[model samples]
Target: MTEIDVATKAPESNATEQPAEPIESSPAAGPAVGEHCVTDRPTPAGQVSTGEIIKINDVEVYVSKPADYPHAPARFLLLLTGGTGLKSINNQLQADNFASEGFLVAMPDLFNGDPAPNTTTFASQEESQSLIDAFKLRIVETAKSFQIDMWLARQTEEKVLPILHKVIDGCRDEFADAIKHGDGIYAVGYCIGGRYVLLLGSDAQPTTPGPERPADEEAGETKTGPLIKVGAVAHAASVTPKDFASLRVPVSLACVENDALFPDDVRVAGEDVMSQANLEHEVRVYPGVPHGFAVVGVYEDATIRGAQATAYEQMLSWINEH
Candidate 1:
């Protein structure tokens, strides 16, 4: 088992729109989105997969259904995209991976098809390989055409949470006939997607400052319950102290070494917040691998690959346990 090390902290918008979108940083927020190069690739060969591209809210979504299971998958998982803005092949493979494990996966295109003004579209792995694989993507400047932060600004929590809810509804409606009783929706987020997933699992927390502020009697607005049953995040970015503070559901966070986005200070400070909140949570540090390794790392070294695999298993075990 990986050693757990996370805690909690702050919030940004009213839970009104649990932004898959990045809002302005509060005092407690982590680092903002970074400029990274992500390419779309097919699911690696030899793993059974059946995935379909569907549309929800006029945006394209990749839905992966269980391929091998004793029974129909009893859980629903929203496989959120990282900095790649949803066309990422890693996201597709992740969706399939979860689906293969009896968790129906619904991954929406956060950026639709075009993430930015000068983005390049690689129709297949062969095409992407020409430039990115040619250079091993060692130089971030090679993919200078695509900037993740420029796109994240447009996909705010207000804009994205509704789509997430719609995805959940569609999944439920599709499976309504087959099963009525099962575990509720769960979320798995990576990179920028991690912040959103945490919000989805959050129970309502105090909006106003101070210890236990009263409800907003002016609007008579009572807080709502969380959107998912359980959640996990890997190498999350743009996460804040406030975001952790508001969380009330069980969550597990996987941290990477010297991450510019989820830096050491932010990660360590989170522990205090979660401890005070007394939330059921686990946070682990996977040394050696870089921040985006969980989603986008392509490693030949056995050790790095093993760490990635183990962290993934830890995520699944946590989800299953909850």
Candidate 2:
């Protein structure tokens, strides 16, 4: 059975040893995990065949290629991690599943190897709970909703879009021959990552030329362009209808029925936008599945597992058909 690839810190060696060779900064050099080099060791059995960190554009991406790599220049799937970034165990499993199935998976560390901003605060449980209570009461007293839109807007523009460009740029620059040559690139996003996926398809064209730009651009002229051909968003949050209307390619949405962030009405609004635009799409509500279902691996509920499996299959099918 396939197992999660957990990153373990090597124990400190007390004895002095010969000086290690100066590392070169090249794809052949492989990525570094602190002082030790990832290329020094082989990917363990049962884990994805090839797992290493590589610089895409300039940002680091944890790439996992299948054992049967170079079989046919497999389709490339650029997966966007949720707010938890690449450390999310469930997100890692999702990427592994795709790589195991012959899709080259590249996941960028959206947080640049740092914890998400809102993940921690106050430095103490008591202080955190007090703030939470005050925040909750403020929300209850005032009808003002959370500023998810503003947060998403800033993140997408400042961090997400640039990283995405770099990842695609890296794919074309470094892995052209290793990956399938065509525009078979796809994207899958969870939570805030899902919102980024929607923004990638959103109507506002990136000021910079990207893979998602019009087909009229000279082919092969721009290697760093947006190349995502299709996409899927799972239990996405903070995305609006205008976002759906801006999509250039077909997309599928695996919405959780119990998603408070992306509730039934929000899902319906997105569907309505897609339909009005006459875009080819699929939007389904997975009953009983809650938000973050795709990114929290420790939750072992049977229903959540089944829902995740179904959603994964649906994304694969959509990518296959489109």
Q: What is the C-alpha RMSD of each candidate to the true structure, in Å?
A: 8.6, 17.8
In model 2, the runs with Cα more than 4 Å from the true position are: 1-50, 117-156, 178-182, 206-226
Whole-model lDDT per candidate: 0.65, 0.59
Off by over 4 Å in 1: 1-31, 35-49, 68-73, 116-146, 177-180, 204-222
lDDT of 2 at 178: 45
Tens-digit per-residue lDDT, 1-322, candidate 2: 1221111111123123343333222333211111010001112235433467777777888787777777766777778876556654445666887788777788888766652433222123453457779887577534312332233334544556677766777787666764455355778887667766766665454445567756865442223323577788777765554455456667888876656666555566665555555566777677765566654353346777777677788788877766
Give the TM-score (vs. native) of candidate 1. 0.73
State how far residue 116 of model 1 sits from its true place (Å): 6.0
lDDT of 1 by residue, 1-322 (tens): 2443443323321234322322233565534665332443334556443688887656678888776543643566778876575656666777777776777678887655655333334333554467656676546545453354456566666566666766666766765532343457778888778888877776652232434545552232126578777888888887776577567777888888777788777766665556555567777787777566676345666666787788788788878776
In model 1, the worst 10-residue window by lDDT is 9-18
Please give the TM-score that candidate 2 achieves against the real structure.
0.66
* Reference-based lDDT, residue 38, model 2: 6
